[model samples]
Target: MDGDKSLFAWVVENYKDGHLICDDQSGETADFLHISASSRTLSFIHVKKSGSSSEQRKISASAHEVVIGQAVKNLIWMDFTALRTRLESPPIEEPACWNSGVKGSDRSAFLAAFDRRDATSRTEIIIVQPHVREAHYKHLHENGLDHEQISEDTLRLHLLEGLLNAARSTTTSVGADLFIIGSSD
Candidate 1:
């Protein structure tokens, strides 16, 4: 599989069971959104590729900034009402891409999964990078992010603890949660 497909598959597999994953194909939406029916969690993931030279390795500072910007942009667009409307009437050109089967039965299940009102109660923004390093984090801290903007929840920095934990889980290479910004409430 190509890089994009591989990354999407990895995300679906790593999210564990009881999660409904869908591709946010609209250019206006994030790359993907994962909804946990049991937990009532809604998470948006923005997958970004590092510069060609940095592929499979640490991301460049500029690339990292771009990823963060996209995350913030998606978060701002993640209005619960808007999301519900979009899900209910998904774009005609954009079809649902469940992690599992794509049969008629799957379509019924997908619609049911998205029909719940609880899924949009909580929100998370995850930036999936190929890899990351301590310097990258430090750089983001020093320059990429604005504390004032974050405090206002404009970028959802408060919900980033999970992403930080994920990043810290591996020292040698950052996994899925490279840069996460999340809603506090």
Candidate 2:
């Protein structure tokens, strides 16, 4: 994908079995809200892109901050009641989210799943950004303590990791999972 919009489309398409109840790429709501009946899980997906494809190999603290902020700020909408309200009556006219693949029957079934969901049902906040490379994040997760101040990029990576950790902690407290979809490079 070239950017966040494309990434959002790809994610929604790839999630074959789930119902994409929300697809608000205009910043008015979550980028994507999905529910999987069989998995009994709901997901809030937020997408962010680096400055350029070349930047994908580098960790951008600013990018992470913006994406994570979006994810954390929208946590209040995780409630089933709030989602139902949005589903029934969108805040704007001709909302793109409401015109998605979800049908009336699908919404009803998903709503039933939401209502009957217990402690076993799971929720997730996903931050999809190509700014942070997977290997770099893993290295920081593993040998971060040993490396003293290496470079500006390293410092930025550390800051990004810290932000991710804090966001994860906040989501965990609310009984949701937090994770990053960083670059494979």
Candidate 3:
């Protein structure tokens, strides 16, 4: 597996027992959406490549913003009734990149896991990069809106709150417990 594909595969393997939805193609909303039945957790993942240079990888400020933005956008989309409906009955055909036999075999469990009435589910917005660096944090502070008035923690909280609000507005009737995870090498 190559860079992007490798990350995708890792995500698939990590959540093998769950319902995985791939949206990595052009014009898609997210790289992958993993909904775990046993845990009642929904994860929206966005994968991006780090800069080639070692220094760049440690300070790719622009990449940080872009990946985080994309993940937030995908989270908002997840709140839509139409998207949730589609998620409930995902296409049977697995993406070519998925490992063999990773496709959802338990249709009943898959459907039940996403049951709109399950109001106590948790949601996560995950951004996977090659690595994270101190520069990324500094960049966020320096470039963030409000002339650096907003802290990184505040910005993340705002985004997560927005996602939870959107999820509540959906037919799911769930008030999602939100979390944001930025994982890197």
Clash count of each predicted structure: 0, 0, 0
Question: Could you tell me the TM-score of candidate 1?
Answer: 0.56
Q: Report per-prediction Cα RMSD to one decimal.
A: 10.7, 3.9, 7.1
Model 3 per-residue lDDT tens digits across residues 1-185:
33555667677767665676676766555787667756767666778765553654433335456766675555556554666665554454544322222564434444455574255677766667654454554565566655637765546645644544553344133333333344442
How far does residue 177 in candidate 3 sit from its true spot (Å)? 6.4
Measured against the true structure, the TM-scores of the candidates, in listed sequence, are 0.56, 0.78, 0.58
Quantify all predictions' global Cα lDDT against the true fold: 0.50, 0.70, 0.56
Candidate 3 wrongly placed segments (more than 4 Å): 1-5, 53-56, 88-101, 104-109, 133-185
Backbone clashes in model 1 = 0
Off-target runs (Cα >4 Å) in candidate 1 are 1-5, 19-21, 24-26, 52-59, 92-94, 99-111, 114-120, 133-185
Of the two candidates 1 and 2, the one with more favorable TM-score, higher being better, is 2
**Candidate 2 clash pair list:** none
Residue 21 alpha-carbon offset, candidate 2, angstroms? 2.9
- Identify the candidate with maximal lDDT: 2
Could you give candidate 2's per-residue lDDT for residues 6-98 as a string of tens digits? 776667565546566555645444687667757867778888876667634666778888888888988887676776676666555544332
- For candidate 2, report its TM-score: 0.78
Please, what are the lDDT tens digits per residue for candidate 1 over residues 1-185? 22555556656655543444455565545776666656645566777653443422333344455656666555544466676665656555445455342212233454465556353355556677554444544545576565544432223222343444433353113112333421111
